[model samples]
Target chain A: MEALLEFLSFQDPSVRMVTLGAVILTASSALVGSFTFLKKKALIGDAVAHAVLPGVCLAFLLSGEKNPLLLIIGAFITGWLSLNIIDFVTNESKIKEDTAIALVLSVFFGFGILLLTFIQHGDYAEQSGLDHFLFGQAASLVGEDLIIFLSVGLLLIALILLFFKELTLISFDRQFAQTSGLPVKWLELLLTSMTVLAVVIGIQAVGVVLMAAMLITPPAAARYWTDYLPRMVLLAAIFGAFSGFSGALISYVSPAMPTGPWIVMVATTIALLSILFAPARGIIFKMKRQQENQLKILTENILKSFYHLGQKHQDMKHRYSFDEIHSIRPSIPKPRLKKGLRVLEKEGFLRKKENSYRLSAEGTEKGKRVVKLHRLWEVYLTEYLYLDPDHVHDSAETMEHVITPELEKKLEEMLNYPDRDPHDEEIPYT
Target chain B: MKKKILQADNPVTEVHDLTVTYDRKPVLWDIDLTLPKGSVIGVMGPNGAGKSTLIKAMMGLLPLASGYVKMFDEKLDDVREQVSYVPQRGTVDWDFPALVKDVVLMGRYSKIGLFKRPRQSDKEIAMDCLRKVNMEAFAERQISQLSGGQQQRVFLARALAQHADLYFMDEPFVGVDMATEKAIVDLLQEMSAKGKTVVVVHHDLQTARQYFDWIVLLNTRLVASGPTKEVLTDELLAETYGGKLTLLNEVSQEIKNKEFPNREE
Candidate 1:
């Protein structure tokens, strides 16, 4: 924790500058990334990131040294070209989008590797930091490099602000944007250019392979937390900046760790946590709600069975054997028997006498309603849907849990006061 | 008919001999259409009948292989200020993170221009549009949280916020619930009454007569087009749906030709 405080302080100017640069770059990329995420073009960033590698190498070969200006220009050219190629292959050929992405990604990455190998073998003395492009070394960013990153980041942010409305319109509805007389072609080009720029700036801190994660995961995580686009963008930027700073700090503290993987790891962890814990859409919460619903259905079904057995016997004390209940619900598993019994007993719907169970007065009424719904659905499905009598039971079983009482009455009327199901079984009274 | 005449007095849009193609295959061929200044016109067609492509071509969303579209006797760009569009519901990503009000405000962007932030007037206009669609109460709601019908209403509200003289909507009723559909129809009628020309691509045959004053019935080309009562006929319906059996046979033959090229038997 003390180490954390020391890292947080800007007492060391170099550390302060690096932290500032990382924060700016990450925030810019994440902000643009929010739109891409919404557009479902998350993998486009990956394709662009990998596609920039050959250009970076070409720039280095031409300049005989690491030139940021030449490299960025070359990266943008190649990134744009790669996007065109991806679009061409997807539209012209029968190749699916995922396949096209994979094809472009592998080919460009292979070319980059080949170029890097050629550079390593050749007699260029100043080609030392070229490997930094692969797994980013944020610690090496200083002076002009930091300045370039910060400026580009600021430019990206400014462009996003200026064209926020147009971008949203195109992203949401390209057809509408076009009809509304917005220059959709120019807007698309602008959006693609911004995304490439974001990816290029991020390659220094997040690296090429994991840069796509920085572009996608933050916004995806933010989506689970909010529905508003502006709030989503802001939250995604914050999450991205947090990941960037923490990853850089961890790598700074532990010299052996790579900055890019750590950043992606942090971002991915946040995304996963959000998917499972978000208030409205969380997986765990949904599962819990589903379980609660299932339990309610099970108890209702048990009460219903008890009521039917009581109506036949005309005695409250008359009990039903487990076998008799199982005969009524042939598809029910043995494990659910204990759970169903426990819920019924807890609800005062059933009282177990030795090995037999009987319905209480309140339980009898609820059971009769359930039986009525089951019979009504069966009659409706078989008669209205023209399903075979044998096929109606399974569908009715599923529908009984979800079909409302209002739907039940509608189904009843639609079937025109049917007396019997397709199986010749009698429907219960109101 | 009374509404159409009042709308015709304004005379907002004109299309002469418009043609469009995709990959050299004609989708919209030699189409002559005109939208009066203030009226709700329904564009209806069977599946694969180019209802969407027509709207797209007119909007400048899709390239026109031949002919052109004019708004108030001006090209699309020159008259952009007077035109607004609402696309099919399925065209957008519902998962987009934006507040309902934020989306509605986008209509005002063309007027506001670049680098300038939306002002209080823009906000008020956006709010008014939302109120027009009865969605003002949901201004702060997130887009994804709304139902299909609500989302359509929000999109309609965005188009309304544009405050343009002409509006184009594509498949606004698709996947929307009955209540939302009724609300949208009512809103479109209101827009036409207020002297805004509105064109919509519609699918439901039952509602076409009730919803639209003028109709354009299409099947790859114009089958019949005029007022709803005159254009929609059993003969036209038969022409649209009658050739399916022959078309299927042609498809099979094409498949055969592809499988065995240059067979001399």
Candidate 2:
């Protein structure tokens, strides 16, 4: 906690440099990674990240020291090479792209490990800290590394903001963009280059093994929150920056922890939370929506059964017994039917008198609307779709619960305000 | 190469000796076609009959193996701004994060050009196009919330926002509801009435006769291309869709085998 406070205060120069560098690195990666996630190329980021490892090790061995410029150039070249190889393998042979990605990822990562082991065993002072590149050592980030990361990261974010529309157009619909006279191929190349650069810049803080996680997880988690591209990009950048600061703070508190794994852990947690709890698209919300629909359908069916009985008896306020309602829909379990009735009574939509149930004024209005929509939809199917009157009832049963009030109004207008359905039933409406 | 001099002054689209190859197999064989201004033309064919390939080739989305396409008596690149395309709905990711209005605004992107953002006038034009398709209420909704027919209408609205002189649509009526189908047909007639050239890749043969004024029946080779009353004969439909085009199929297979000797399909 003291170390975190110290880091935030910027009193310690080294801690400030590491924190700032982590933020810049992750923000840029998330910016470029949004498009990669949209492009459905999540594994491509993995391949490129792993592929840049051997290039970093080679740069270390050739320069005999940690030269950030040489390492970035080396990483970019190898990353670009691996991307082409994946494309080439997919285009040439019968091998699919996923298999090709797996192949290149393993091969390049294996080569990087081999080079890393060689550098670790050498009798040199500078080679001692080279192993830090495998699992990132953000605690070791210096002033020089911060400068390189900041400049390149700003360049990446700038390019993305400038060509945001073109990238989004290409990502969503490539064929449409091409037909619209946009230079799609060059734009694609530029996007891929930005992705490669992001992976390269991110490797220092998150390292080769966990870089793809930072690239893919933020955008994927952000997707659950928005349906706008610009907002999604901004949210992903914020999420990435949050993960970076948390990872850096944890590493600073404990000298034994690595920044890469902690960063991935934070991102994974965010993604899991997004999947479980986001509104409209999340698993919890989807299940909740399904349950609500089932309850709605049940309530509507009971009300509709009441309407049928009332119509048969020629009495709008007629009461019906449990046995009679059960006979109306035999498929609903007994307990579920009781539960539906209890819920309706609780909501003041129905009134219980001894063993029979009758609709309240609110319940009657709601039930009439349901019946009106169902019968109207039935008439529409029969009149326009030419369906037999017998076949339209089963479809209208499902549509009655799902159709919104707006669609029901449209249906009424389209049917020219008909009062009777094809089966000669009255569409009750006030 | 016999050039048809008739209607040379105002031909909307002209294709000469066009052939498209996919994996060394000819999809659209040597085709010569010309369309006049202000007509709803149907490019009718069966599945795998290069109906989509022909539309894509004209828009320069697909690489042509041979020949060229001329629009407004000029090369396609010279007048690309005047052309708009609505590709197959199945080709795009419906789950992509974009609002209906943002998608319609993309139709104005070509006019908006690079770097600069879309202005207020552009937004107004996009909304106007949405109103034409009766989707103004859904302008702010995510595209995935739309029904299949509504999605098709949204694509039509995007194309309408382009305000182009020539429009190429691939399978605009497939999987759409009855109301959307009627709406699209009415929009096509309205556009044609205003002197716009619209070409649709139609699948249903029964409606093709009534929906379009001119039809281009294609099955690898051009079976017929003329006015609907003149070219939509029972015999031409048989050649275009039935097994009567087996010879053309065999010839295409032979060409594939000869040109790509070592390649496998």
Candidate 3:
């Protein structure tokens, strides 16, 4: 706890520079990455990340020192070139974008690794921190390097804000943007430049190999939580900054763990949690909704069977044995049938006498509504769709529990309040 | 290539020798046609007959191998606000995070310009367009929640929000319900009545005559372009459908077969 507090305090310049550098690198790339993710170009971000290694090595060799500005310029050039090569190859040949990405990343990255080997073997005095670019050394982020990353990060964020709508329109519908005279070519060039610039700055903190995680994970995690673009962008920025903070802080306190992999790990953990727990779109919530729907259908089907028996025997209050109900609803498995009965009884929808069950007054009304919906849908299918009476039952069987009261009213009016269904059975009254 | 190519003296849209190529192969051959102002025109062709390629080329969405398109006697870049396009419904991802209203509001962005967010009045216009398509109640719903017919209706509403002098629609009625078809046709008629021209790339033969005032029939090349009565003739339709015209030709052939009783049956 004391180490964490000490690391967080601005009294230490190295710790402050490291944390802010990680934060800006992540937040800016996440902002740009949201659009790339939306455009379904997540793979392109990965390719660009890998392809920038040659640019960094070339920048180091030419400058003969670790100059942040020269490195960014060189990295930006090769990163931008990588995307153009992918486009050029895909357009000119039968090679698709994926294959093009693979080929370019391998050639560029292989060349970078070769150059890195030569530099390591050679007697270079200023090559002490050069190898840190491979795995990333956030704890070693200097003040001058932090300023360069900050300036570029702010530039990226400003450009995104200035052209948010235009970028959105183009990403969502490029042809529409063209038809509207939005200068799609210029906008595309601008976006491509922004993407390259973002990747260039982000590669310093997360390194080339793991730079894509900063770009892809935050936005992907944010998408699960919101359906609005601005909100999604904001949430992605927050998630990215938080992961950057955690990664920097962990490495700062421990001094042994690499910052790049830790950032990726934290971002991935957030993505997994978002996928499982976010409302409406989350896996767990979706499964919960499905289970609830299945249970409701099961319980309603059981009640519907009871309603059928009472109408047949003219004994609304008579309790039927579990065996008797099973004979009618044999489609429901034995275990599920018992569970459904228990749910209905516990919910006050069924009056239970030992192992047998009958509908309560409220349960009887609800059962009547479900039956009415089934018969009404049947009448609609047969009368309007020209379907045979038998063909209508299967469709109505599923739709009975799905229809809402407002839709039921509309169906009633559209079908003109049919008295009897195609089955020659009277539809239950309201 | 025919003298029947409907060239209006004062055309709303004019295409001169427009050729579109896909992967260096010409998909839409040299096509010269003109659209009259305040008319609902239909371009009908069999599948892969370059029906969509023609409109996309004219709108400058595709690279023109040759030729140019002019609207109101001005280049497309000069009069963009006076023109609008609705691409095929399935052209974009329906699962994209947006409300029905947000998409409709995109149509107003041409006037909204760059860097400026949509204002309250722009939103009101989008709402009004949604109301015109009978989708005002669904303005708040996510686009992915819409059915095929409802999505088509929303596309129509987006185009309506443009309020352009000329409109281009690709396969607007395909895969839609009878009510949606009726609603879109009625909306088209209403637009024409208000002195706005609509050019639809249509494929259905049964409803072509009723849906459009002018018809352009194509089969990789222009077969006919004139009034609906003249363009939809039996010979022209047979030429447009080509030898693979299965559904219409089979029905007509069956009618003749039934009359003659010449089959083995």
Maximum-lDDT candidate:
2
Per-model DockQ: 0.54, 0.77, 0.62
Tell me each candidate's TM-score: 0.78, 0.88, 0.92
Give a tens-digit lDDT track for model 2, residues B1-265: 1111123236799999898987667888888889878999999988888888999999998888888999998999999888999998889999999999999999988889888899999999999999999999999999999999999998999889888999999999999999999999999999999999999999899998889988888877777887888777877777778765677667768876676532233
Worst 10 contiguous positions by lDDT, candidate 3 chain A: A128-137
lDDT of 3 by residue, A1-430 (tens): 8898898776787787888888888899999999999989998888888788888889989988889898888888888899999999999888999999999988988887888888898887787776666666677676788898889999999999999988888889888889988989999888888888888888767778888888899999999999888899989999999988887898788877767888899999999999999999999999999999999899989889889889998987779999999999888899999999999999999998877788999889988998999999999998899999989989999999999989999999999888999998899886
Rank candidates, lDDT, best first.
2, 3, 1
Give the per-residue Cα lDDT of candidate 3 at A320.
92
The local lDDT score (0 to 100) that residue A319 gets in candidate 3 is 90
For model 2 chain A, the run of ten residues with the poorest summed lDDT: A123-132
Query: Ranking under DockQ, best-scoring first?
Result: 2, 3, 1
Candidate 2 Cα outliers beyond 4 Å, as residue runs: A1-10, A297-346, A350-360, A364-430, B1-9, B243-251, B254-265
**Better lDDT candidate (2, 3):** 2
Clashes (candidate 1): 5
DockQ of 1: 0.54
Share of reference contacts found in each model: 0.86, 0.90, 0.74
lDDT of 3 at A247: 75
